[model samples]
Target: MARIVVIGSGMGAMASAARLAVAGHRVAVYERAATYGGALGRFERDGFVFDTGPGLLHLPAVYRDLFVKTGKEPLERCVALTPVDPASRHLFDDGTDVSLPNASRAQVVSALDAALGVGAGERWGDFLNRARDAWDRTRRPLLEEPLRPDWQVLGRDPYPSVRRRRVLRRDQWAATVGEIGAWELADPRLAALLESYALAYGLDPRSAPAAAAVLPYMEQTFGSWYVRGGMRELARALYERCLARKVEFAFGAEVVAVTEKDGRAAGVELSDGTVVEADSVVFGADPRALAGMTSGRQAWAPGDVEPGPVPPGRFTVFLALRGGRPDGTVHRTVVHSPDAGAEASAAFRGEHSGRPTITVLRPDDPVTRPDDAHEAVTLTATVAAHGPVDWTDEALVARYADGMAAAALPAVPDLRERLLWREVRTPADTAAATGAAGGAVPPPALAGAEGRHLHTANTTRLPGLLLAGGWAHPGGGLAHAGMSGALVAGLVVEGDGFRGSQ
Candidate 1:
């Protein structure tokens, strides 16, 4: 059995450690922080709790597969996963409101038709069917496997974009998310709904490839899930699974540099001046830190996918309200901005948009509140990743959070009066917690725009070193991060010929 050293204790790292251990390798995970989970953080006060990371889980089969591969107990036995009904409530600026049922195409169609117009449902249904075609085309290459050497082939757009006739008698093709929305959806509300997914995932709809439609298709088709306590529970379950698989963890052990012997990875040098030897190194931290550790050693040769620019982080406000959660309240509510395109433009430009696209989450879980008489609510918005705006500036963060809460008024009509206390977090906190450059959250890989949307492969030019995390192959989002681990393990255990899971 080879001795493997895994960096960071985030879900992706832990998932790799568990799988490698089960494969009979001796694995040790060294984390810079005192705890694991990375972005899957939590906030609490007076028995009120809020998930600081992703509020819901889409494509949960990633974790389910992880649990099954690593341990005797299944994922269901480790954590309570419940389907979130009325998957999401969209509150458009035009006073158009609709709640889509979880993974029920007919129900989603009916709801949209009733709220937007008679033809709206059919339009959206047709769009989703097209989105499904994209998903089927890219799912295996993008999610179920490691980034291939001939990844440029993925540069081809797989969305089967609709073609239209232009005034000049030329064929107009939809390439970006915005073009797809404008040309196909043909409804401002439908366009906003589609663009919201792009913004939430740190992509501007104007530039994000039409393949991005796969995002909504994945969510509406697979359905959204919630853990009993919070998303933190999913992390805890994965960590515990790692321990059960005999993967050792060294918390607060920051790796300073990667040691090399005869131009191959020999071990890792810790911040405390300790050198730990290993046969292979699995880095689950940010690519920035990896570069620092590699010294002059290049991780990628020419033509390899370059790590894209750091993405914008999220701005969150956790509210402890006195009023109980009202009945018939949907778990997730998205309040669209008056001009979503403008908001997205401002965000990408690192400027503040007067109107913000707000996502309000109020899970119907008891542990989040002190009692049934109280409620815990979370409001979040996409903002410039910490750099352009000083997220460390307290006054600035509070001011932005104030706007987010105000924007959320549509979701919580009595937000001001019901609020008892509030907590705000910026990308600065994310930077402190996970050491990501600019506190940026990585975006998932998309199959278009000349492969500008793909992430660096797991296998680096530096032998014996691989990547598995948000910044790695398959890219970000809770589910994709887990897939990175699976890919890393498959590469290590099965050698270079490993394609992916069957």
Candidate 2:
């Protein structure tokens, strides 16, 4: 049995530690922060609570598989998950409103048709049909399996674009999500709706590949879920699972350097110069930082997926309201921007824009409120990271937060009247919390656009060092992180021959 040292306590690293422990490898985790979860966090005030990270879970099977492999207790027994019915409510700028049901394609299609027009649902349904085709084509190589060295084929677009003729342009297939919306969907409202999916993941639809359809396809097909107590509870469950597997943890122990004696990774050197040796090392952080520690040894090769442009981050406003959550309310609502194109461009370009798109989450679970009389509302938007914007400017933050909150007033009619207090979390907070350089949130790896959407492979050029996290293979998102951990553990236990989870 080899001794494995997992760097960072992000969900991916923790998941790997648990699996490695179950495999009989002595696993130890070192987290720089006092807490285990990376982006998953919580804020509480006056008995009201809010999740600071992802509001919902997509593809829960990832965690379920982790629990089944690591312990006898199933994931359902560990964390109480509630399906978000009417998956989401879309508040378009044109006063068009819609409530899409959870995991029910028929219901969602019907709702879209009823609200938008008779043919709107059919167009959306057809788009999803094509999206599903893309999902099936790339799901394995892009997700379930470990990223391959010669992954050039994955760069070919899996989304079969419908050919359309544009004015003063030759007939062509829609290459990007923006084109798909414009040329195919043909309605500005529908275009905004399509772009919202990409924006939610910090992606720009205009540049994001048509294969990006997989994002919405995965969510709508599998479902959106919420933990009863907040996403933090899910993190707590995984941390506990790791502990149960006898994995040791060291908090406030920052790994300054990765020590190397031979050609392979030897161990990790802590901030205080304490070196802990291990046979294998799992790094759950930016590959650049890992390189800095290993004498500038890079993780990716020439053809491998290298780090692309710096990513955009999330801006969130948490409201502790005086009134209770309304009855029969959709758990998630997206208040669409007045100009989706402008918003997408600004976010991707790392520029500030007024009236950015916002996602409002209001979970009716009593656990989030002080009592039945009070409620908690979280409003979030995709925006430029802390560096581009003046995050330290108090007035700027308040202005942005106010605009986002006001956008949700229609969804929560009594938002202003039911007011208590609101706290804002900028990318600055994300940078401080997750240690991302600019508080940027990496979007999930997508197939197409010349492999530009892919992330660094889990297997590094270094023999014993591996990568796992939102920044690694399969890329960012709760489920992808879990998959990263599984892949890492498989590579560690089964050696270089390991393919992936199954």
Candidate 3:
């Protein structure tokens, strides 16, 4: 059995460890933080619990597969899945509002028709159908595979000149958001709706790929699901599975470097200068950070690679409030500003705009608030990466806090008084804590096939290494990250000659 070492305690890392352990490999995971669930991790403040990142859970089946593959059932350990009504409440700039219900396609159509127009329902149905087609054609080929060497292709070599070109076709769609905006939706509102999906990945819709259109379909068809207690429960369950399988976990142990011997990965060096030899090392954090940890510093030359534009980071505000829930609040709400596109552009260009698009999430259902109980609200808004107010000043943090209060809370007035406790997370925090480059969530935003060419799979780049985090391919979502871990385990098992066909 090969000794596999995985970095980071993120969902993907734990999942990959569990899969490998179940396959009879010796696995050890090193997490820099003193906890499991990197971005999926949670914290308690002022008697209220808040998930620091990734609040929503979707595509549960992807997670279920991980448990089944590991000889366990997700439902047996994790909280029961609950369907959210009005999947999302969209607050438009013109004072119009729409609620996407969790129901049948016909019901969704009826809801849209009632809100938009008589024929709008039909148009919505058509859009969903087209999106489903795209999803079916792409899901298995791209998301379900270990996107690596040209040999992993399912069929004949189509574009032999290009490497790893089996994922998508370059000429199929335009790579820029402006180009994709023109092709998919005619109405400006529709284009904005399309952009919302890209925004989920910390990307602007205008430059985000057209294939991202599949996001709405997944939400509309499968619906946005939630774990009963909280999303963190999902991470906890995966962590338990790793323990049950005897996967060794080294929490609070930060990896200082990936030691290489003769052009191959030898093992990892810990922060305390201890080296752990391994047959393979999998990085569950950002690849950019992984590049910094390599032994051959010159092997990773910045000039050797053509870097893509970094997506904007977030300015998130978490509030613990002591008051009755608002009358019209839902699980998730998107408040659009008059100039969302312009504001997003400014943010991408490292400039903060006075008004930015805002997304608010409530920990408790609006209809279920108790008489004297408090609610947890998470407000996320785009901010310029230019350090927020006088970039070099030490007081920039205070300025960011003031910015959140002045800009976000006014829109939802109860936010100020009901706010029992408040904490803010900036892009800087994400980078320092999680090693995410520019604090970006690397979801697959490649436009068409050519754009999807790069393999972000954490471990694919190195023969003896594995990648098990949101930064890898199939990027940035709890379920997708977990699936990536299982995929890596599958590769490891296959590589080790464990062929148990189902």
Candidate 4:
């Protein structure tokens, strides 16, 4: 058995550690913070609780597989996973409202038709079918396996080529997401709905390739889920699973650098001046921090492609409400911007918006509040990653938080009056929590534009060194991050010939 050292206790790292341990390798995880889970953080004050990270889980099968591979108990035995019916309520600027049922294509179609127009549902359903084609074509290469050496083939857009009649000649099928929104969806509301899927994951729909359609297809097909308490419960379950497998964890242990011996990763040097030797190292950190640790040996993984601008980070407002959550309220609501394209432009340009597209989450779980008489709500928006804005400026952050709350007013009537207190979390908080560069959140790995959406490979130039996190292959999001861990373990355990878990 090889001696493996994993950096950080992020879900991806923990997942890999547990798997490697189950494979009979001695594994140790070192986290800079006092706890694990990375972005899957929680906050509480006076019995009001909030999930600071992702509020819902899509593609939960990723974690289900992790639990099955690592322990005797299944994921369901560890945490209560509830399907979020009417998954989300969309509040369009045009006053068109719709609540979509979870993973029911027919229901979603009917709801869209009822809310938008008779033809709208048909158009969206057709789009989803096309999106499914893309998903089926790319799922195995992008999610189930490590980044391949000949990854350029993935760069080819897989959104099935289409032929259309034009006034003068045949029109070429759309390439970028913006093109797809304008050409295929046609209806502005439909375009906005499609774009929202990309925006939520820090992807700029305007520039994101057409393959991004796979995102919505995955969500609407697989279904959205919620844990009993909060998403933090998922993290806790993962941590416990790792412990059950005899994977050691050193919380608050900061790694200073990745030590090398004869051009191979030898071990890691801690901030406390302790050196832990290892046969292999898996780094689950921001690209910037990982590069710093490598000390000029190699900065990027093979087949790594730059996706142009750095991805944005999340800005959140956690509200401690004064009143109870009303019955019959949807679990999540998306209050779309008046001009979503303009909002996307302003966000990518690092300009703040007084009216931004906001997502409001009001889970009915009792553990989040003191009692049924009270409620906890969370409002979030995608904002510029750390460097562009000074999120540390308290006044600036407060104003942004207020703007988010204001934008959410349509979804939550009398929102201001219902709030007893509020807290704001910025990209700076994310950076501090995950060691990500400028709190930048990486979007999940995608195909199109010749693989621009794909992140660096898990296997690096330095032997015995691999990556396991959003910054690595298969990219970000709760599910993809878990896949990153699986890939890293497969590579470490099976060596160079390891393609991926069957």
Candidate maximizing lDDT: 1
Report backbone clashes per prediction. Answer: 0, 0, 7, 2
Q: In candidate 3, what are the lDDT values of residues 1-502, reduced to their tens digit?
A: 8888888888888888988898899999898888888877565665566666776777777777788878656554666678888788776666656778874688878876777667667766776776676677667655776653342342221211112222465345344444444444444555555576667656666655556656777778877887755688888888888888898989889998988776667789999999999888888876666657884342223222223555667667777778766666688877766676787777777776666767777755432233337787777876555343233344765576666665554346767776676777777776666666656555652325444423354444456665666666666677678767867777777863422223
- The Cα RMSD in angstroms, rounded to one decimal, for candidate 1 relative to the true structure is 0.9
User: What does candidate 3 score on TM?
Assistant: 0.85
Instruction: Please report how far candidate 1 places residue 499 from its true position, in Å.
Output: 0.7
Sorted on lDDT, best first, the list reads: 1, 2, 4, 3
Tell me the TM-score of each prediction against the true structure.
0.99, 0.98, 0.85, 0.98
Screening candidate 4 with a backbone cut-off below 3 angstroms (N, C-alpha, C), the clashing residue pairs are 155-450, 155-451
Which prediction has more favorable lDDT, 3 or 4? Answer: 4
Write the number of the candidate with greater TM-score, choosing between 2 and 4: 2
Instruction: List, residue by residue over 371-454, the lDDT tens digit for candidate 1.
Output: 999999999888888888788888877788888888899899998999899998888898888888777888889999999999
Candidate 3 off by > 4 Å: 148-184, 261-263, 297-307, 326-328, 365-372, 384-413, 445-449, 452-455, 458-461, 496-502
The Cα local distance difference test for each model comes to: 0.91, 0.90, 0.67, 0.89
lDDT of 2 by residue, 163-222 (tens): 876787887878898998988888888888889999889788988999989888889999
